[model samples]
Target: MIQIANRTISLATEPFVIAEMSGNHNNSLERALEIVDAAAETGAHALKIQTYTAETITIRSDRPEFRIEDEGSLWSGRTLFNLYEEACLPWDWHKAIFDRCAEHGMIGFSTPFDDTAVAHLESLNVPCYKIASFEIVDLPLIRLVARTGKPMIMSTGMADIGEIHQAVQTARSNGCGQIILLKCTSSYPAMPGDSNILTIPHLRELFETEVGISDHTMGTGVSVAAVALGATVIEKHFTLDRAAGGVDSKFSLEPDEFKRLVEDSAQAHASLGRIQYGQLANEKTSKLHRRSLYVVEDVEEGTIASSSNIRSIRPGNGLEPAYWDLIIGRKFAKDVKAGYPLSIDHFF
Candidate 1:
């Protein structure tokens, strides 16, 4: 189990819903505060942001490999440095954002890209740290964040089993005992077929830690499905309005959609009560409506019971349906009325 602030996140608890406010503030502190308020209003357990500057994440290079030329990418034709510059949240804004989260009773944390970012978040006494999918291979950064002894949530997007093992080993050796692995599809606005949320439980079993999904799918379906499969944490990008247009607004959920996610994911978690086959309390009353052997027609005393007089029917106050064949040639001990429930005593 992982506890962030006062919230307990585990397979046994309700899903820990996180509203990732990544660059959706549109560079305005006022807008950022509003996003925090909106996120809290939606009943999300926590809010997360990215802590990095353009210089901290990448250099100003015009190399072909440094540019996103994929036509399928949202930032097509943009250099990595330029995109980071536009999307990077200012370090000076962390305190205000964290303070706002505290005011609203939400846990505030960030994804640290380097040693400097890690130290900065540590000074703020952040409760936990998240490792973005792209940074999963940065062993040095992982070790630095883990040294804080805070809970860590790492996204496994493009990583294989070996890479995940290395990252988890690094964190454990460095001091972080509370780790959450989130199955992630790195594509922006990820497709449903590519989500593969079934990995959630496998990740928990493989790493023996809490598992979740950093969902990029358009709706809450994937997240809810993840909870049913043992996801204990759900992180999705949040934005005030996609129409307003920000770095991640295109794939981010609006306030109402996020609220639905919070509700639906919790419902999905509640539905996974346990492995049970016996009738439930609510089902006890309905059991009477199930089909069982009943007398379909009136019969004189000493008359032989058969298909014409007895058969399986509803209102289960009768012999079990399994007894139907055995009772077929038995003589009736007493006259049974039409629609009467057949009992073992009625047969001789």
Candidate 2:
């Protein structure tokens, strides 16, 4: 089990829901605080923000590689540096955001994109750190965050098995032992078909650590399905109003949608009780409604038992259905009514 703030996150507990306010603040501090309030109201366990500036995340260059050329991308035609600048939360605003989260009883943390961002988050005494999907290959950054000895969550978006293994190894070797690997599809507004949530369980088995999903899908269906497949944490982008338009507003969930995600994901986790069979506590009382051997017709003493006199029926208060063949040729020990339940004392 991993403890974030005062809450324990594990397979034994409800999925830890995180409201990721990544670039959804619309670059307004007031709106950012409002988003925190909305998230807390939705009963989310934690709130996450990104900690990086354009300078810290990328270089100012017009090179083809530095520009997003994919027309399908949300920020198509924008340079990576400019996109980061527009999306980044101001470092000075971190304290207010964290304090607001605490006031609302939520654990506040950030995804650090660079070593300097890690140092800044450490100064704030944040409870944990998240490694964004694109940085899973940045072993140096992983080591830097791990050395802080805080629990770390890494998103495996574009990473292959070798890259994920290296990142996990680096973190453990440094100092962080509480690590969570999130199954992430890097595409913004990602399609459910590409989610591949089945990886959640495989990741846990392979790494011997908790696994979850950083869902970018348009709705909560994917997140809820992830929990059923053994996800212990669920992180989704959140916004107060998508129509207001922020960097990630196109894909982020609104407040009501986020609330549903929290509620539905918990229900999904609860449904995964265990590898169980037989009657449960709630089901025990309903067993009486099941079919069993019953005296369907009246029978007098010394009467021959036959299919016409006894049969499997509902309101189980008779011998089990398995005994039907055995009682077929037996004689009645006593008189029985048409509605009476059959028992050993009524048959010889």
- TM-scores for every predicted model: 0.95, 0.97
Q: For residues 1-348, write the lDDT of model 1, one tens digit per residue.
A: 888779899888999999999989898999999999999999998999999999988899999999999999889999999998989888999999999999999999999999999889988999999999999999999998888899999999999999999999999999999999999999998999999988888999899999999999898899999888899999999999999998889999999999999999988988988889977889888977898888888898999988888889888888889887789898998988998888889877
RMSD of 2: 1.2
Candidate number of the best TM-score: 2
The candidate scoring highest on lDDT is 2
Clashing pairs in 1: none
Poorest lDDT segment (10 consecutive residues) of candidate 2: 339-348
